[model samples]
Target: MLRLLKVLILLPITAILVVFAVSNRQSAVVSLWPLPYEIATPVFFLVLAPLILGVLLGGAAAWLAGGKSRRLARERARQIRTLEKAATTLPAVLS
Candidate 1:
């Protein structure tokens, strides 16, 4: 099911990229940023920018989520350990 969704998504993306590549074969100077870095070939940016941004954003989001998940797991484990220690000592204290 997941694979089917991935294939469906990629089909349109592949088509769009093919069209973008065909349309942007010419070398056009793109000065959208504060610091203008020239792309000798427009096709490179057309294909690469989104891929790079996707990877960067995915990595950042994953890193943030991973930290939170790790923290939560550690806290849960700590609570469990404390509870177990208390349970082991309760009979000794009562006696």
Candidate 2:
């Protein structure tokens, strides 16, 4: 069922991308400042590159932002384990 849903969603998107790439097959020149070399690529690639880059960067940023919360969760789990160990040892030591 999940696979069917994925196929339903992805099929149309893939078709659209193929159409877009075919329609925008013109060459585009990308120039970088302070560099002597420039890249000549397809218009579809020029349109898609920044979008892919943005998604990657945004994912990285979100992962980095979650680091603190993840760390806190680990620390909390460690504290709970330590407390459990201490509690388990207490009765033996007392007896």
Candidate 3:
């Protein structure tokens, strides 16, 4: 069931990508200044590279932004464990 759903979703996307790649096969020159480096690549690749990079950077940024919340949750769990241990030991010490 899940496999069928995945296939259904991916089939159209794959077809679209194939069409895009086929239509945009022209070569494009990419140059980086101050380094005297130039690369010639397909238009499809030129378009896709930046998109992939943006997605990766955006995901990394989001993960880093959530670090504080994750750390706080871990600290909260540790505090709860310490409190539970003290509560269990308190009655014995009192008696």
Error of 3 at 19 (Å): 4.1
Mark the regions of model 1 whose C-alpha exceeds 4 Å error after superposition. Answer: 30-39, 43-51, 70-95
lDDT of 3 by residue, 1-95 (tens): 99999999989988998899899999989899788999999999987789779989999999999999999999999999999999999999999
User: Which scores higher on lDDT, 1 or 3?
Assistant: 3
Q: How close is every model to the real structure, measured as TM-score? A: 0.49, 0.66, 0.62
Per residue, candidate 2 scores C-alpha lDDT tens digits across 9-81 of: 9899889988999999999898886998899999999878887899899999999999999999999999999
Better of 1 and 2 by lDDT: 2
Can you give the lDDT of residue 4 in candidate 2? 100
**Candidate 1: RMSD to truth:** 5.2
Report residue 85 deviation for candidate 1 (angstroms).
18
Better of 1 and 3 by TM-score: 3
Error of 2 at 33 (Å): 7.6
Candidate 1 vs. true structure, TM-score = 0.49
